[model samples]
Target: MRKKVLDVAEEAFQARGYHASSMGDLMATAGVTGGALHHHFATKKALALAVIEERVAAAVEETWIAPVRMAPSAREGVRSVFAAVAAELERQGFVRGCPLNNLAHELSLADPDFRIALAGIFSAWRQAIADKISADQRAGRELGTDPQRFAALAVASYSGAMSMAKTAQDASVLRDCLMGLEQGVMSSKAGTRRRSRILHRAL
Candidate 1:
């Protein structure tokens, strides 16, 4: 029952803004009495927190973090993620945008607790990419740019790209934006290698 309520809560919150998704609507959709709902969640805020901490966090892990970590090359993994999402969105014939980002925009400023929980997810996401980039750099695969800075830029670029895609109702916008980012990163990598070769010859 708790899981069922949570599933319903996540969908409701995503489909409707936090304020728009009233408790009454949730109870009706979940087919639970108000007592049963409150027995599990205590309040709507508690329910939202749980959704953010659990559902949203898990989605980010599966959708973004896992892919970035799994690829043989960190930069390739990041680019593939962007390409895959854009392809899926185009196939679906709609643009739902990034789920974590959607809620971040809606609830980040709504409450301090919401902001903190959401920030924690973002931090974990950034850390994953930064760690991957650092490892790749150490391996001499992508010895360009600061890992933390690149991670920050990637997160922000994806968020902005998703927003643009949603507004334009075109998934290609995402591909375009992300591809530009990749070009910049690859240019830096090439430049760094060139400088390294020059210094090696001088030594």
Candidate 2:
């Protein structure tokens, strides 16, 4: 029953902003009595916090963190995630935007708890990507770039692309953004390698 409420609530929050999803709407959608809803979550804010900590956090972990952490390289992981997400948006025939990102934009300024919860998830996501980049840098694949900044760029690119895609109702925007980002990363890496070789020979 708690799970049911959380599941439906997450869907509602994602589709509609937090402020717009009234308690009555959630109760009706979950088919739970007001008393029962309060029994699990004392307030709508509590429910939203639960969704952020449980559902939203898990979604980010599964969708971004795990793949980035386990992939062969940072660039490959990011590229694959972009490709997979673009494909998924196409298959779903709709771009509602990323759930975490959507909620963050709407609720980050609404409450301290909401801001903290959303920031934690974003931090973990960025850290996962940054860790991957740092690993690659150790192996000489990524050079002359701060791992954290690069990870932030990747996150920003995807988030902005999703927002644009949602507005355009086109998945191609995501693919197009990914292409440009990948080219930039590759170009910078190659330039770094050239400078390194030159310095090594001069020494």
Candidate 3:
């Protein structure tokens, strides 16, 4: 029953803003009594926090962290992850924006707890990307750019592209953004290699 309530609430909160999705709506959608809902989540805020910590955070881990961690190259991992997300957006007709970003935009300003929770998720995500970049740099796959900065750029660009796609109702925005980002990464890496070669030749 708890899981059911959470599932229903997560869908409701993601589709509608957290404030707009009332407990009555969630109870009706879940087909559970008010008592049952309270037994699971005493407050809507508690439910929202749970959704962020469990569902949204897990989604991020699966979609971004796990794939990048397992990939052979950070460049390929980042490119492939974005491409996959873009393809999924196209498959779904670009209706829903990112769930975490949706909640962040809606609730981050209204509540301090929500702000902290979303910031934690974003921090974890950024760290994962940064870790991948650092690994690639150590392996001589990426250029000399700061891993943290590159990770921040990748996350910011992806989030902005998602917002643009949702606004335009077109998935191509994601594809184009990712393609341009990947191209820039590859170009920067090449430039770094060229500079290294020049220095080596001068020695």
Candidate 4:
């Protein structure tokens, strides 16, 4: 029952935005009475927090953490992560932007706890990408820029693209953004190799 409530809350939060969604809405959607909702989550804010946590966990698991766990190489896994997100957006017709991002934009200012929770999720996401970049470096894959910075940029760009796509109601914007990002990463890697070779020759 708790899990059902959380699941319903996640969908509602994603669709309606955090501030716009009420506990009553959640209760109605989840088919639970007020008493049952109170038994599980004492207040709307508490339920929102739970929804944020669940969305963060699910996003991390689906995008970065789980793919890395299953794939042969961290780099490939990271690619798969972004690809999966793009695929989802395409399938859903850009109706739902990222849940964590949407919630953060809506409720973070109103709720400090919400900001902190979302920040943790974003930090974990950036760190996972950075870890993948580090793994690529260890495997002799050249990344043209600082791995940590590039990782952060990639996550930011992807999220921003999703937001823009949702705003424009055009999925092609996301496709173009991701394609450009991938090309930039590749070009940067090439530049890094060229600089390395030149420095080695000078040495």
The digit string of per-residue lDDT tens for model 1 on 1-203 reads 89999999898777677889999999999999999999999999999999999999999899889999998877887898889889998999988778788889999998999999999999999999999998898888666678898899888888899989988899998888888898887788788889999999999
Please state the error at residue 75 of candidate 4 in Å. Answer: 4.3
Candidate 4 per-residue C-alpha lDDT over 143-188 given as tens digits, one digit per residue, 9 for 90 to 100: 4556678767777876787788778876666667767877887788
Q: lDDT for model 1, please.
A: 0.89
Task: Give each model's whole-structure lDDT.
Answer: 0.89, 0.92, 0.87, 0.77
Off by over 4 Å in 3: 187-203
Count clashing residue pairs per candidate. Answer: 0, 0, 0, 0
Which 10-residue window in model 4 sums to the lowest lDDT?
A: 73-82
TM-score per candidate, in order?
A: 0.92, 0.93, 0.91, 0.86
Shift in Å, residue 24, candidate 4 = 1.8
Q: Tell me the alpha-carbon RMSD of every candidate.
A: 2.1, 1.7, 2.1, 2.3
Among residues 3 or more apart in sequence or in different chains, the pairs in candidate 1 whose N, CA or C atoms overlap within 3 Å are: none
Model 4: what TM-score?
0.86
lDDT by residue (1-203, candidate 2, tens digit) is: 99999999999999987889999999999999999999999999999999999999999999889998889999899999999999998999998999998999999999998999999999999999999999998998776777998899899999999999988999999899999898888788788889999999999
Worst 10 residues of 1 by lDDT: 137-146
| Ranking of all predicted structures according to TM-score, beginning with the best and ending with the worst | 2, 1, 3, 4
Instruction: Mark the regions of model 2 whose C-alpha exceeds 4 Å error after superposition.
Output: 194-203
Best by lDDT: 2
Tens digits of per-residue lDDT for model 3, 104-189: 99999999999999999999999998999888888776657778887888888888888888888888887789878878877886
